[model samples]
Target: MPVAVGPYGQAQPSCFDRVKMGFMMGFAVGMAAGAMFGTFSCLRIGMRGRELMGGVGKTMMQSGGTFGTFMAIGMGIRC
Candidate 1:
């Protein structure tokens, strides 16, 4: 007979871990949205590759930071 082991040797994640994961997911989504918006705005203003890439990167970081902060606050309030 062989013993069975759970995947990754873990059954479930802790509450804090789950909350962190959720915050990261939210940040990722926000970053994507920011990038899309930045790209479109830059294109509308006739920006080329380098400028467009720079705008997208800046927007993504800003949005991700905002999202993560709000997520942490909301989680704190809930807990």
Candidate 2:
């Protein structure tokens, strides 16, 4: 186990542990939330019978790209 000592046993995680944990947690949470919202938004768009690309698709694509870019930037900042 990669443990660090402090007031809290988990106060500091090793560099490798931080990277691994960050990736795992971020991926898991992101996927779950993204999937749920994506599904909900798709269904909502369908119900409206709007041109998806003109209406919701563009927003969705932009949001996805932004999310990815921000995550990449955040990881870089962490190091």
Candidate 3:
């Protein structure tokens, strides 16, 4: 993407850029939370080895995507 010069030689991010930033931030936070909870949940259910890793990964992606979507929407609206 080309630099977007706005007003006085300063580059400005578009609304989509703001939304994408929001999604990335939310995704990072959500992935951390999901990893913590998913690990405990998988362990409590007696999952071991590869099964445990798979469960954790699945949970992480799901939660991250969900949180990212909401954050993007909220940021887009504010923009």
Candidate 4:
């Protein structure tokens, strides 16, 4: 097969590499979703600006932990 090269002259990634890349992209997206969920949940419960800001870190940590666990499980099954 002819190897495709980019501007940096790196050869094209293999199928597994592509899959890993996709998984990382998905992981980032999940983290963003988790952050949004945390923010919205705090707001919906009537938290004010300062309270909301204070809770954001904790909420994001919890959300990220949960999401990371799920992702790990999924990747374990697939890989």
Residues 1-79, candidate 2: write the lDDT tens digits.
6455888554675565555555555555555566567657866857455554344455445555556555655665686
lDDT of each: 0.77, 0.58, 0.93, 0.70
lDDT of 3: 0.93
Best by lDDT: 3
Give residue 5's error in model 3 in angstroms.
7.0
Off by over 4 Å in 4: 1-27
Clashing pairs in 1: none
Off by over 4 Å in 2: 1-13, 47-79
Residue pairs with clashing backbones, model 4: none
User: Model 4 residue 50 lDDT?
Assistant: 88
User: What tens digits encode model 4's per-residue C-alpha lDDT throughout 1-79?
Assistant: 6878889998877666655655565566666776788789888998988898877667766666666666655655665
Clashes of 4: 0
Q: Order the candidates by lDDT, highest first — what do you get? A: 3, 1, 4, 2
TM-score of every candidate relative to the true structure: 0.70, 0.43, 0.86, 0.52
Compute the lDDT of residue 17 as modeled in candidate 1: 65
Query: In candidate 1, where is summed lDDT lowest over 10 consecutive residues?
Result: 1-10
Candidate 1, number of clashes: 0
Give candidate 4's whole-model lDDT: 0.70
| Residues 1-79 of candidate 3: C-alpha lDDT, one tens digit per residue | 7977988999888898999999999999889989999999999999999999999999999889989889999999999
